[model samples]
Target: MSDRRMSNAITRPRRGMALEVVLLMLVMFSVIVLAGLSAVTTISRTSNADYHGARATYAAEGGADDVMSQLDAAMQDGIISGEDLANIQSPVVSGYRMTQATRTTGVPVSRTITSGPFSGLYSLNQPIDIEVTARDTSGNRATAVLSVNAQTIPLFQFGVFYEGDLEIHPGATMNFAGWVHTNGNLYLSSDDVRFQSNLTTPDSVFWQRKDSNNRLYGVHINNAAGTAVALRFDSRSLSDPLFKTRSQQDFDGRLMSRAHGVKPLKLPLPSNTPAVTLVEPRVAGDNSMVQDVKMAWKADWHITLDASVFTAYTAADSNTMKANFCTFLTQERSAGLALPSAAMCARIFKPRLDAFYEGREDNRVGSTLAIIRPDLIDIHLDTLRLWSDSAPAARAPRIIYINVINDNVADTRRDFVAVRLRQGAQLPRSRVAADTGGLTIATARPVYVLGNFNTIVWRPAAIIADAITFLSQPPNPNMDARTSWPSATRCTGSSAGWCDVNQQAADMNTARSTNVNAAILAGHSATPNDFMRVGGSQPYGGGLENFPRFLENWSGATHHYTGSLVSMFTSRYALGLWGSGVGGQYYSPPTRQWSFDVNFRFPERLPPGTPSVGTVLQTAFRPLY
Candidate 1:
């Protein structure tokens, strides 16, 4: 009985030990499972925080991009100023909050760009530093900074700016003393051409044959020697020593001596529309916009004035005559004698007209409204002949505005109106205190300046036209027998062979020295090849060297000219190709004395219809904290 009781006690102790081991194992397993779960939760929370931070960074960058786009648009619209940029409001995107700050200083920061077509020392406006901060829902924050440098481009600053190819190869010794730039290729070939300024192009600069031939008719620099001379200049040097002698070769080896191959650049003018403005002379104390007239035209019309009109003005009181003429025009319009179109009517202020005709002797500045249909009127320079009986030197300026007409008119072959400036004719004038503002003739039509324009005085003047041409002599005065008529066979001989009647007649007149001292904004000749072509036994039309065509024999005379030449659109009538080896046929190449008037350097002396170029450059960008 004692043994059995002891065995039962041992069995009970063993059972209790097994139960304790199981309980300990279960507690250890539970602790390990809890630790694993805690570790997974910690890793998940850390990843979520990182994701929010990345999102915040993206949001900040997006906000910066948005600001840049908005600023660019505003700058292009011609409304962005330092004041406007300073007042930009911060934008909120998605669930992120964005805060922005802008800093602007009036001082301009100068930078030299070395990579693009605009590579030059640019005096950019003060840097505008924009700092943007974005915060996400979980307190994740990111910050970005951007720097914007806006540049105001003065159009007159450039000696020449072309939207298309610029070809300049004068046979005579010519010196261009201003910065020349082109959006297209630059073709230069001359024996003694000196560019005293910088020549830049977005496209390649070619000195080889314009045709597909291997010719040494390339460009020459200071070295008067042949093509083997070593070019001697650096990339930004005043002298360009690069020449593409071979057609198939690249601009490497010796040709890249003093030149820089640059990237393309955007034109400074407005992209949507040509930047054109009509500015009236600022009177002494007139500070309002009312005095500045913004001129616009729509259709076509012709105006004529007889010697009797000026005679009538000379006899009657000037003011009373002007008032009476205005009254007459009003009455006529009411009676349907003249159409009530913008081109037909004009706001004639006697003070302005009197100021224009102040120094003249005839004082024939009268308010006469003459409007005739395009089909009924003769569009020639002689049609504007002032009364020969009147004082020759006392002629007053004549200003007219033509409206836009239907281009699809069946009978009208020319898309633009023709303004012919006859020889020995005087342009209108606007009088200032000491300096005189010369005639400002503007039209949507193509203007042909016959000979010796603005030759009498060195007055500030401008001609704004769709296209401009300088005829050595006058065009055919016959209205019905004009050269531009498609059906006319003047170019086609009576029996055989194509003959240019205008060219033939122009060859007969004597070429005279042309003196033009005015600003010209004309259209670019799209068919420059045709306009500059030299063919036939008497290939007379001298190339661009003689842009103002000469018909007379100007063997020993010099073409003295001073003005700014700006081309904006494709030419409508002056499309003729310029050629080589045709000297003294059409016009004798003059000792070219062309220069950009220094007066244009001043803002006050800028001619009317001048456009502006916007150059916004980026300096630096980085993250803020």
Candidate 2:
């Protein structure tokens, strides 16, 4: 019995030991669970912070875009003045707030990097730097920087800007300075020609004819007088090292130190149909009936001619003279007034015309006239007196716009208006003029500048025409007019002595240099078929080399000229043919001394009809963190 009691006591002690071991394991498990929970909580908080930072970065980008948009809008609206940088606030987006500040400066002038198609440093205003700061609700922040440039493009800044192909294949030595750009391909050929300025184009530059089996002609650099034949390029490759190199050892294909390709430059027109616009004028017409008056509203002066006078002259005139005289005018009378005939409508509504002219004064002398058609209007600079030294601004006409036909007419021919300067007429003078504002003459029709226009004064002037032609001195100096007119049977045909003396002046002095100073915007002959060909066999339009169409022989003479030549459309009439030697068929080539007018560089000296070219370019961008 004693041994059994001792065994029971040992068993009870063993049970107590087991319970203590269990309690220790429970405490360790609780410690491990609590540590795991703490780690998970920390990770959740870090993830939220990172997500907020990313959101802040996106907000900053949006803020920068908003700031730039506002700045562009302000500039376009003319709200931003010079030296007027200001702070701007951006609208809150998705609980993010943004603030912006702008600063502008003039671009530093660089002589070496003078001008180019894509270079904005020549603009009057320099770069605009914008700073944008974006903040989140949790105080996380991000920032962005952007740079913008606004430019006012002057058309005359370029020596030549053509919407179509530019062909510089001069037979004689030619020197051109200033920026040159073309939307179409550039064709450079000739024996001795120098381009002293930057040249650019969206299309390829060809040293040879792409259609003529790649025929290469040579070109020179910076030799205006053609005395030296330095720096010549005959390579037809655009990737040729010569195109990018400026060293004298290597051919300078670009002529200038810096030359590169650029995106297409867009120039907006005032109208889509007419493609041009000028100062306001009065007109009365419909599809069938149209009446146009020239300077009729002006109180200064008036000139008129009667249809009866023309008919009487036609009765005793040659068939050719009668047909040319009444080309646009009708012989029939309507409601006691001369009405434009159906033939006139058909001719005017045609796509184009060979030429059109209207005399400033009434050549008939005694006949009173009253009818004017939209297709034909007289450009009487002598009578209208566009130039005057003492004329008041109100008295003088600044912009002259002629609408050849009413806008209602859908026919392209109805849109045609021909402005022919009186043969051998001289443009009015601007000598000692108080008002220095320039003059702009714009027309939708082809314009023929008879002879010696704007030669007396170096006044600021521009001509915007569909096609421009310069008729040489008449074949017969004794003829009454450069244009054909009805011959008079009797010596004293009319009381006004209109037929007594031929209006055509004696041929211009071939020895004396002919000076033409103005900005000329005309059309180009696209296909060979569109070229102005001679009327007879062996037709040969002078090509783009003779862009200024001529009719008289100009052999052994020099033509001195200074102006900007711009072609923006296809030529409506091809250039006339030419032949070699003195008194040859058509006209002879003259020594061309053409130079860009430096006065055009200044905004104040720009012509009245200059078009504004605007572009907003992003110069730089950055992210701040």
Candidate 3:
């Protein structure tokens, strides 16, 4: 109105136009604010997801460590009894609750103990599976799983039977409530076990004794001055007449008669058996006194044993108290009888084939030594040490069956020195070279024949022990080999030939030319050029990709290879268990350690009316206007 004089300049602004401009500016400002908010929200959500994932992974790892500790305890204390497992079912730590479960595959428990009762390589096989699941109140959870295999000693099956020099190591102990026989010198170090022959007592079951406090303990052997060489025991219960009240010398006479095919003179016993004594009856002024052994099985039981004094049991006189005692112990135990005295147990294991009982010919090796009944696969080196150290301890070739636990031999590999041979074979040099011979593992009972002169020699179908040992050392990694990857140099040190990886993709051609490729392809499988994953047997990781570091070929090419990339995290050997296919051909970031597991379901199609939690969908892109 003030400029009402037709001033075209101040037209007072059109009302509708002003309103439209205001709205447009407001819309632009709103769009900018919304975009900023979305970016911030995305970043926050991503960070939270990463944090939770990390936490879950750590929790799972903690669970694994706990399970390992439990296993260690069981091993140190012998077999893991049912009671031990019960403890695992509900383990509590700090404020978290842990639950555990077990599952077994392959063979059952009973067959293992009964497989080859009379075979030297008979195996009492049993495998155990352990799974631990942990959860906290804060909606956090973790799981860990493990498996262990144990082979029990058949010491209970066939009483003690030995032929050579029996050396009970300083810490060794033998607890038997059955008859024992030996034809060799029995040397006892520290006292830790007891030998009894009385099935009448529930404590008759074989029990090893330990003398925590220094106590005078040991077996009282009554043998000739220097003619003993083996130890034997009765497998049957202690009540057999042969094991009753015979004197140590009388037992020795019976053993000689049995080994030479001569009839044993029956000895009379007192109508009223006096309180049986554990010491070998001593003849006044005789040089051959019973050698004393300390007891390791600290049981408060009373049964009597008459032992010889001389450390050796090799007296030549046919009627010498020492000789009679040694022979008696040997023959009676083999026949499930007893040597009333140490003399009868001496010289029981003569090499004469005619001296062996029928069907027991296979049981008897060279001299008077008879194989322990209940064929057992020689698994633990320590068990071998115990028996081999005993009288007539012949480490005859026997099939040793074992389940493959881990592949990479190096994981649990240690140089085993001093390998004693059994009757018919020659002993190898003391030291068993690493990565040289194949390590046998038994899956099923001693079903398949492994070796004849030896017990068994079955090889696994998928993974072979030979392969595991062979690959233990660095394979021919093409050190001089050149590769094309992001930014990297050639490998340094003994592990050369492959490229020194530094965030890059290596060419497949370089991989095919290296020794690593040669070794892998040697396995008779398609070769993936980009990576080298390696792990196969027990004690070692599994699969190809599970290997610590490897090369991967993302690009689809016929024959391409990549440089070496170390995981800096996993076991020495790479494992390819995860991912698709038998050999993990696909590659991903290296795993620093054992981590959380991700579950996948079958049938790619989703159920009707269900929203996908974390999945990708393909659709046309559209702009919102």
Candidate 4:
């Protein structure tokens, strides 16, 4: 009985110990499970925060992109107009909150660019930052910043800049010494044509002629060492597989087009807006957007015709109208202008005209071409006209804006249509550099420049016209065409509309090799320009070598021209075909002695009212959260 009682006591104690051990293990397991659950919850919360942060970051970046696009649009419209700034709104990203985009381009700075394609060129630049903040509902936020710059660059940077398809098919040995760029395709054809500098285009570069499939030899472009090398193939002509290898074989990247990833050079105008408006005189009813860019708005003297009466107005209104152009010239001679007398002015410009002419336009017979010459009204602001920001006024005119408004279109002759610049060798203002804004003639009409111009003194001079025709240099006895022309030079005074056509042709035929030193910004005649495309063989528009219209047969002489040549638009009023002459045939090609004047690269030397191209470039990007 004693042994059985001792065994039961021991078993009870062991059972109690076993119960305590099981309870301790259960408590430890519960604690471990709770700790694991807490860890899992914390990890999940961290993951959610990470996801929200990434979303916010993405939204911020997207908003930044949206701002960039808006800025690009603003560049097209001259940057930051009242309406343009309003268009920059934050983007909508799903599940992300966006803050209103903001931009700041402090003060604009003007300086010479020291690198890149525009190296050594001066430009006005405004650097600004675009910032956008984005947030997620989970309390995560991110901010993105994009650095950008807007640049206003002078237009004459290119030696030759064409807005449309450019064709250089010179028949003679030609050397072009400046940078050449075209917004359209480039047709490099014919033999012995050498481009001395870089050639770029936003379109394709062809090795064939614009008029036919004929591809002559001896067409070369510049290499890095400034040597002319044969440009055999490019992205268009070379094998697609070897384009990267072959294109860099010779030119050293100097010759490039869109196929090589060249972007289009843009102007600061609305989409599809014509750049020709920069030269056209602003009319009374022009839109507000065009006012700031139009060079004619700054005309020192305004000339217009009304009721068969012509007037050179000092201001926009008739109250500021000077006098009858005929009487005014005679009076101006006493005022030290040395203008033509009243009778001479009337006889030179005004005449009875046939209602219409029988000559064809664009080479069509019986087309009844509008009589184009009698409408050549002209003016001589041949005196010192000092101009100031305030009413200091112009002592002599440096800028003349001429607009011919006939309103007599019903008469079929299209009267008062063109302006000619004569006696301009010694323009009104002294030819010196003081930022005095040199001689600039702005007109939208087809302009005729008679005799050697701006050559004698040659201080920054420019002619902006729809089409510029360099008339044969008049015979000079050391004189001015307006005040001192002999009877044989040009039809003047009472010989106006009745000028002998045969005699005029004789004068043009006798044109001597002349020198014209001025920058010419004018229109070019367009052709079908569809050679080797869907259709083939379009009529060529005289090519770039003959861009300055000639009217003589100089078998042994050269037309010495030195300046920048820019063609911005197709001829509007002067619709005559380039090949067709004044009386069926006008001129034989002269030895083209043309070169780009390097002086234009200087900012102080740029002609007054020089139009510039606006561009946008992204500088940097960063993300903050």
Instruction: For model 1, give the 10-residue run with minimal summed lDDT.
Output: 351-360
- Total backbone clashes of candidate 1, pairs 3 or more residues apart or in separate chains: 21
Question: Residue by residue across 1-625, what tens digits does model 4's lDDT show?
Answer: 6999989988998999999999999999999999999999999999988887887888888898888877776776544553665767777788887876555568878887654444455788878788889887778899999887776777776788888988898888888888888889888887798888878776778887777878888898887788788868755666534654655678776776765654455565666778888777667876666666676676655555442432233332232232344433212111232333444444433322221121213243234433343345544322222122112222334555666554365533334356666556655454333544566777887676766677766667788888887665554545543556543243544321112233232233445566777888888877665766746777778778867776555556667888889888887766666665335655567778788888887877777767777656677899974
Candidate 4 — what's its lDDT? 0.65
The reply for model 4, stretches above 4 Å from the true place, is: 1-45, 114-120, 235-249, 259-273, 306-374, 378-393, 407-416, 430-433, 475-510, 581-585
Candidate 3 local lDDT, residue 121: 21
Give the total clashing residue pairs for model 4: 9
Residue lDDT tens for model 2, 1-625: 6988999988999999898888877888888888788777777778887888888878877877887776655444222444335545564677877787777766522222134444622344456778878887789988888887655465666677776667676777777765677766666667766776656675666564422433334565443332334433432343445555532334333432223434444443211323122212334431110111122222122112222322233233344434454343322211232223444433222221212221211111223431111233335354334323235333344445543323223433222345655322333333236645666666555666544556555567777766665643332333223234222211222221122122222122122235566777776554342121222232223335566654333466556667777776665432222332122333445677777777787666767656533334566788886
Model 4 quality (TM-score): 0.79
Better of 1 and 4 by TM-score: 4
Q: What pairs collide in candidate 2?
A: 305-369, 349-413, 349-414, 480-502, 531-574, 532-574, 532-575
Model number with the top TM-score: 4
lDDT of each: 0.46, 0.49, 0.26, 0.65
Q: How close is candidate 2 to the true structure, as a TM-score?
A: 0.57
Clashing pairs in 4: 347-494, 348-493, 384-395, 384-396, 385-395, 385-396, 386-394, 386-395, 386-396
Residue range 262-372, candidate 1, lDDT tens digits: 322332323354333222212345322222222232111223222122224554335555444332231111112233232222222110111111011111112232111
* Candidate 1 wrong stretches, greater than 4 Å: 1-129, 134-147, 209-417, 422-431, 434-439, 455-457, 472-508, 527-556, 576-589, 619-625
TM match of model 1 to true structure: 0.53
